[model samples]
Target: MPQLDHGANALVGVMAAFGRFELQQELSGLTAVQAWNLLSPFLPLSQTDPMAFTELLCHGVTPAGGFAAYGASRALAELVGLSFDTPAAQAVLDGGIAFLREAGVPPMRVRPYEWDRWLDTGGNVESWLPVRPPPPPERPGITPLRPAETRLVAKLGAEQDSNRVFISRDGTDFVAIVDARYSDEDPTRARWVWHRASTLYLLYLQVGRSLQTPPHWVAAELEAYVPLPAPRF
Candidate 1:
């Protein structure tokens, strides 16, 4: 049996960011598109699935999470030149993110995925805009809206966008959803942020925001993650 409590959190964290809900899929049971469609409601956008997300997380027919965790540990151990991954266990201290810790592991730092030193400067929205903003609303209009109406609507026009993040027009962007425990809700209350992101962004958060792996990271899956078949473990 695979111990989800041991090393599965990292895989869950990564896939969940991309709104991948079918984390339990097995390579032997489901096709890529089947798993993708199974997770359809969890995604915030009807737009095409992220180009590399499913690929990076899923190598073959399904996600095969159990195997993925084994792979994560294998990758981490190889990277650190160790037989096990405890030495590279991640932690969080002071409000900032911490990668591998040399001391007793502390709690994980859960920040908005986009948190950075720039936030330490106490910058406002205007400070980080890639483009200029329009002047204050000339009239009372809450026409603008978030990409999803799943959450409660406090305002109609300008007041509506608060529940979501906005990206520039004609530019590429990614939304990483996190802290979403509401997998079964009609409209999940998972926290999501739309930020300018890249591959570096993923690595940056992956390293900095980790802490001790939970004794057991819950398996959110539709496929049986059986480990009895793998040759290495």
Candidate 2:
């Protein structure tokens, strides 16, 4: 795995690799101290550094050239969840939850998805532009929201015109939905998909399982994930 010092873009690549490989075993010795060193190298002091950790989280995922702070925070939360049995790790989790509860406004919510929205010739509204791509698939077993209210959070890829990230958060928990685009004219080309392939998604899923409160529908699906059966000869 790339060191967090390398930057968030590198971390995002690492998250995607996890989905393609069953390498949870690789993380076997990944203790909270190690995870802290890997993710928040900004604080070289220790794992229990809530003041520094919270400040970084509040910085809105601006690790060099990254925009997904939620993803990074979720990744840390996953590590915290896996090792909550340890007193030190538990302290980190406690500090994080407390930070969330006490924060007047999280940086995650305050940052703009696009720093250059003024230059966006297309504008931002989903409907005002053109075709209404079918909504992303309802999570496997979760009841589909008839008209789920979602807001665009980030746009991924080089073109800055595709792979949209949308989210619906209800204060305590949030579900991120990906609306992947390929062609503008072909409605069939558009697909709504889970963000599972991304490290951010996987981290959130792992941490969600460990949260005391009910996990979001998307995160819950990770627990139920099963590989396809092999072809029988």
Query: Using lDDT as the measure, which candidate wins?
Result: 2
- Candidate 2 has a TM-score of 0.21
Candidate 2's C-alpha runs over 4 A off are 1-46, 60-67, 79-233
lDDT of 1 by residue, 89-124 (tens): 211111112111112122232223323332554643
Clashing pairs in 2: 15-199
Question: For candidate 2, lDDT tens digit of each residue in 1-233?
Answer: 11335455554444323211211224334554544445454434225554444344334232322223323344445433333344433343333333232332222222232212212334333312232122223434433323446655344444545565555543434556666655676644354534332333443443333222221222333324312111111
RMSD vs true structure, all candidates: 20.6, 19.9
Task: Give me the displacement of residue 75 in model 1, in angstroms.
Answer: 41
Worst 10 residues of 2 by lDDT: 224-233
Q: Model 2 lDDT vs. the true structure?
A: 0.36
